[model samples]
Target: MPETIWWKTGTVYQVYPRSFQDTNGDGVGDLPGITARLEHLAWLGVDAVWISPFYRSPMADFGYDVADYRAVDPLFGTLEDFDALIAEAHRRKLKVILDFVPNHSSIAHPWFVESRASRENPKRDWYLWRDPAPDGGPPNNWLSNFGGPAWTRDEASGQYYYHAFLAEQPDLNWRNPEVRAAMHDVLRFWLERGVDGFRVDVIWHLIKDEGFRDNPQNPDFAPHQPGINRFSQVYSCDRPEVIEVISGMRAVLREFGERVLIGEIYLPVERLVTYYGPDLEAADLPFNFQLLETPWQADAVAALVAEYEAALPEGGWPNWVLGNHDRPRIAARVGDAQARVAAMLLLTLRGTPTLYYGDEIGLGHVPIPPDRVQDPWERNEPGHGRDPVRTPMQWDDSRHAGFSAVEPWLPQTEDAERRNVDAMRDDSRSILTLYRRLLSLRRDHPALSVGGWRSVPLPPSLATEVFAYERFEGDETLRILLNFGSAERSIPLEDDAAKQETWSVLLSTRPGRAGEATGNVLHLSPDEGVVLRAHPSS
Candidate 1:
């Protein structure tokens, strides 16, 4: 039998620190707030919590622009508060993974501050900087992901610095051995603090092409798309040298045994899998966001899952992400009913699953009033703001949804009055209940966790709307059936199992479906998902 790995099989729950919970009535969540809410995660049955950035920062791009890697931001708490968070999480048998932003640092960081001081400063080469073009324009045609030219001129020094996101966040020169060493120490600092692992932010952007070339224009660029899409980012991101940097980070985690490295790479599956490196030396799990990008159709999703499964390197574990701090919620993307199916699909899949905070309770996008907007991207590129999905978590119907005594930094969903953890916990058929059941099932069954996965072929009549797959290990076999369409459909299992054998419904999105017996043909309600346990008919 293969050795069981915690990160490979455990489920991950992402907590957007600023919005998760607030204990000090400061209108923002703190580390102590997270420690207080650990019971909710433990009761929900998740194996780990991946907390987003809480590092000391200037808040230009929120905590992603780090001013200090080792110190916890005062807005969140102190270093002692972080230590307490991990210690308490470990006490609850839940692992804690921190968001590690290595690609860039806040312009306020001492390192960047020193580097931008002067052209002849010893730290001048620590960040990407160049002289103006002959036309006195920015250094290159490379565009920032947050819109505008990637280069921000240092008015005092007359040199331009590059940033992939906000100008307040400067891209570090990964080619600099000192920078690499410094970032490596950052990992060691957390690992030594007993952090279970790290979710490396924008990991693919760690290294830029050495030639400092202009990114080619994207032929498919549209007027409505974000300006970054104007260029293909060929020379700006996912450079080959980034793999070596990933391996170095992986080596640091290796020094602290049993630690995991999860990289956030926004690329196609074929390109995404390469970060695993030869023999899996890079990220332990390069996050798989296919579910977030694919069309909400059975056929499209089926193909995506198959493509991702095929693209994984040998022995590389697979993972699925339904939502995150950066993307729209699943409920908003596919509607409430389909979001239930998404939960089933995520937890029942063969590898690790990351549950975005508030997703378990069916939180959707909340309309943000212009005056309340906090995300800098919205100010930079109107319409591309992620503030709607990064709102405060809905814990109850209390004022501020019980997240804080005062108003939160962001607004809560309009339906938070009834759609909250406290309310959902009392309702048997709530999306939150469905999530807990799915997670509980994963915990009780190896076939659902560290099992083998195979797609089940469906007949042409049901092929476009219904997706089915099997998870099996030893004598345990479970079949998952999902109906992505709005219309009810029936599918037969003749191709999957013997026609005479009956399958027992282990769990279903719809109430009263469990414990029911179904034969070769299974009837499914619209936008419903079911898990069936197969055994020989006595």
Candidate 2:
């Protein structure tokens, strides 16, 4: 890897706009607030910021269901505010990537409104619409990702429309060229506005099965929610035609120099890699979500790393995301103590690492009272809601967790005082400090940022509890060792001759240590990890 490779040398920080900062005292984060915080992010040492959707929407699915793709949402400030934010980010040498919602649009959108007005409307074919069964039931057994039936009936037209999500989010008919052109126009809108790139939402679901056939039944479905065990949805998403559309999107991105396009795909490694396209004319980065699905084990993680590396496309850029607005924080998923180890693994890996908001401070999931839950998915499915992860970011120990002057849209965590940026900024041992150090180290070292990765097989005695790998660039080699278990472990380096020389520890989770190394054999405490670079002079 070379430093010139854009994806290899940058750290991306994801910001969930609504919970980031609120300057208007209206209890919602806006673009102006983000502009005000550009200096803080620049000081923290990130190369780019991926802001979640803030486009004009109906709030049915927050900003995911866009009603107007070209304008900023009123709740998130004006178009001028967005321009200021982008300008400020560029001034701080940070790239700004806006979220692009292309799979569906709010029903209130003018296109959908016209499409659903009547069967004779010119835009009727823009969205998926079909006749109902003779018995007045849905056309097929498709199910929404959120819950319930995927199709909603329209009384005026005597038909039903397909929606893989909420009914208010009508799925766009990608089979229509007009719809594709319209989406491309939306892309041009942001590109012309000087946005560095886009984080495409549900990119895989842009096209559906052309035949509109019924999906297979999911035999392993649980009874926790309605339609959980109903259909497999194999044909409803990730259609082959998606690749062609993505190629077109990549073509548009090429017109702008050094612009990036990342896709949100939840498929397996094999399917996910296809989003890179056959000729590398697709998403610049298809999110590697192995951390989201993999079991937290030494062997499991090691195997997953090897598998993902092997599966990547030729010349394809790699990226990793441990936490996001849609998923629980890595700290809560693997316990607070293991969070540091997770961060080390993320930063040391061979890809651009994306850190979710508040993850640096070890923010846990906020308990959303049943009545206070605002997430539509969680509200519809009480037990399986993602509200816990989507809570307001804890900035300080204020009444509203310093997120808003009034009550936040979502409830703040009770322990926000102890787990906020203000408190952790001065605490040397806090997770925030560890993140800052690790990010700084990654930025300072070309070996850590753009080096080739090779898994260092530990001795059988150490393999069960320890996961280690070597990242090399020319003659320089950096070894990263992590103990996934809760006990002391010592691992012998397989290449004893290579390790005979003294090594300088670059970074570690253990406190009060900087560049300390002993010999070929190294000792690690429970959940402790270190990054060591072999010293050539010694």
Candidate 3:
């Protein structure tokens, strides 16, 4: 078996703080709630728990906007609560990763407050600020990701400041040496507290073009897309200088030893791979989101996997994400039946996998009433809100899905009564059980964890709807088959082992299928996925 590292071989579970669990009945989850629920993650078999930001903030962007990088928000808990949570999580052998927001800060941050106070302030250059155009309008044609112009007028300073998302969240001037040093200090602070790593938010947007040039219009821009897509962000983000900044962060992490750095990058595989840095020193994992953008068909997904696998630089570790707080759940995106198949695909792929908090029990999107809508993006662009995916986690069939005594900050899924950890843990056919089984397999088999992988060729007729691959370590080989279609299919094994090998079903998404034996031709039910171990006929 190859040398293994915790980040390379372990799965990461994302815990969205506000919606995970509420210990104080504040309708919002806090540090204590997460600490209390550490047992659940340990029981679920994930290797690490990545908690979204609990830093002090005004919640303009739901904790993405940081106010105090060093302190936990009062709403989440005090610094002591965070310390206790870390201690408990470490005691359980679960690595803790914090969401480190480096791109922007809330307008209320002391640095931003001082920057906006006056153009002549000592910290005035801490954020991106520019003079108005000759026409007395905004500085540039840049558009905010949330809606209008990326530049917001600071009437007090009589200067326009840039904000990539909301006006209340201003982009920091990363070119400033002081800003970079301060952000680096934030990473050291958490590292000192024993955090296993950080998921660096918008790491690609750290440095912008020095010339303040306007982004050219995207010729393929469509009306249905967000306004920010109207122009390609060539100058606004992903500048070449950003790599050095990341390398600096990597240097700081190396000081702490074995600390992982995960960057939240949304670029194409070509650009995304560059974040790995020279000799793989920058981002340990740039977070692959190809599964989110690809068409949910067997052939399309298969091609995506092959492409991502080919794109990785030599020795550069790969990672995969199926669902997150920002996107629609996999169950909603591909429907419930195929979600089980997706779980198999995500967990068995040749990389690290990130599981969204409620995905283990198959939580789909919950409809948000207009009165209950909370995502600021929805206010900026109607119908584009992410509230549906960011709802409270369904723990049980209790009031507020056992998430809170009072109403949850967001509503629960429609099927929370039946689709919860407590309800699914005992159900053999439930998605949660399937997840646990798969996780256990990963733990028990080196072939499933730190193994070499190769695509398994299927017959042309089955290739369009049946995707197959093999994970092998030394003498152990495991084959994974996924049926993306709704019709029953039989896949023929064409390999020349005298055509008399017996395949044992180690695990199957469909219930009552494990321990079943199959001949050269393997059968599959609609939307079913199975992991098979081939035993040569004696």
* lDDT, candidates in the order shown: 0.91, 0.86, 0.91
Candidates sorted by TM-score, descending order?
1, 3, 2
Candidate 2: regions farther than 4 A off: 1-3, 224-229
- TM-score to native of every candidate shown: 0.98, 0.97, 0.98
RMSD of each: 1.2, 1.6, 1.3
Which pairs of residues have clashing backbones in candidate 2? none
Clashing pairs in 3: none
lDDT of 2 by residue, 1-538 (tens): 2357565589999998888889998888888878877776887788999999998998999889999999999999999999999888988889999899988999999999999999999999999999997788999888898888899999989999999899999999988999989999999999998988888998999988988888997887778745644777688988888999988888888888788888999989999999999878788889888889899888899999999999998787778889998887788789988999998999999888998988888877778887887888877776667777877777778777777899887887778878888888888898888898989988877778987889988777777788999888878888899999999887665466744666767778988657676566777889998888877544
Candidate numbers sorted by lDDT from highest down: 1, 3, 2
lDDT of 3 by residue, 408-450 (tens): 8888877788988889889988999999999999988888888
lDDT of 1 by residue, 1-538 (tens): 1338899878999999999889999999999999999999999999999999999999998899999999999999999899889899999999999999999999999999899888888888999999999998898899989889899888998889999999999999999999999889988998889998999999999999898898888999999999999989988999998999999999898888898999999999889999999888899999999898899999999999899898888889999999998888999999998999999999998889999999999999799999998988888899989999899888888888999999899989878889889999978889888999999999899999899999999887898999999999898889999999889898887673443456889999998899998877899999999999987767
After superposition, which runs of candidate 3 have C-alpha atoms over 4 Å from their true positions? 497-501
Clashing pairs in 1: none
Please report how far candidate 2 places residue 416 from its true position, in Å: 1.6
Query: Which candidate wins on lDDT?
Result: 1
